[model samples]
Target chain A: EDKVVQSPLSLVVHEGDTVTLNCSYEVTNFRSLLWYKQEKKAPTFLFMLTSSGIEKKSGRLSSILDKKELSSILNITATQTGDSAIYLCAVDPSSNTGNQFYFGTGTSLTVIP
Target chain B: EPEVTQTPSHQVTQMGQEVILRCVPISNHLYFYWYRQILGQKVEFLVSFYNNEISEKSEIFDDQFSVERPDGSNFTLKIRSTKLEDSAMYFCASSALPQGYRQPQHFGDGTRLSIL
Candidate 1:
């Protein structure tokens, strides 16, 4: 079975503080990794990492993948109260059948004012 | 921006009853998927549909669960028999292509199903 594990299940940080969330996975055929942000309802797409070393960035958020270690990290710099939300990591494994996406129990972030 | 839309922001049903959740994915997207998240739990994959057929499904998707494109724009998930365990937030997602490496899925605001 494909498995994904995220570290620091919960984090509490003050506004303007920087935080990093980690995700590691074990799969038979790894194709790509994706990150999502969930506030109260639906999750919104963040970044999809396919290659290692290169970073994908959007505003204050950036993520990088390490294929050699089978892990990825999401960094949020100068975080604001609006950035407080669950950060989810999912992996897509290569299969002859349809694409299967496995998600890690997300890291819940709480940003204090 | 185009978004996937789901009807009935919330639904309450009795056990053993049948329920159909509706969704209309982003126009022009070819692949569709259904996922669920129990409160305080990880989001689980239920099924994926493409080319008017089922491309993949998880063990959670048993005989009681069925999906259909039914019409040109709507995708539906029907649960023949509901259980208390079935209470969760069901999400509909769509992507422009089948290849994960090419297109990432966009999710809808999910319908919260409460089974009594």
Candidate 2:
């Protein structure tokens, strides 16, 4: 089975603190790794990482994939209260049948202002 | 920006009753998907559709569940007989390509299905 594991299921930090969320996965044929921020009822798209070493970033949110280690890390710098939400990690594997994506339980982040 | 859309933000149905969850994917996207997230559980893939046929489905998508694109703009998931455990948030997603190689899928807000 394809499995994606996220660490520190829940975290609390001050507004200015920097946070790092970890994701590790085991798949048959890895294709891409994606990050999502879910607030309220819907999950919004964040970043999608396909290659190792190269980091994908959007403002204060940045993510990098390490294929050699079968892991990825999402870093939030200078966090704010608005950044508080459940961060989801998903793994996309090469499937001839179709595109199959597997998700981790997710890391709940609470940034106190 | 174009996005996938779902109807009936919340639906409450009794066990053994049938339910249909609807979604309208992005007009230009070629592939569509259905996923569910149970309370306090990980979001799981249910099925993927392309070329008017089911391209892939997970174990959770059993005989009781079916999907159809009866019209050009709508994708629906039908549950023949809902069970108490069938309650969850169903999300619809779409991507520009069938394989979704490098294309990121856009997801709808999702429908909350509650089976009593």
Which lDDT tens digits does candidate 1 get at residues B1-116? 99999988999999999999999999999889999999999999999999999999999999999999999999999999999999999999999976554688899999999999
Pairs of residues at least 3 apart in sequence or in different chains that clash in candidate 2: none
In CAPRI terms, model 1 is classed as medium
Highest-scoring model, lDDT = 1
Regions of candidate 2 where Cα sits further than 4 Å from its true position: none
- Per-residue lDDT for A14 in model 1? 97
What shift in Å separates residue A88 of candidate 1 from its native position after superposition? 0.5
**Of all true interface contacts, what fraction is found in model 1?**
0.67
Q: lDDT tens string, model 2, B11-102?
A: 99999999999999999988999999999999999999999999999999999999999999999999999998999999999898844458
What's candidate 2's i-RMS value?
Answer: 1.5
Off by over 4 Å in 1: none
Best-fitting candidate, measured by TM-score? 1
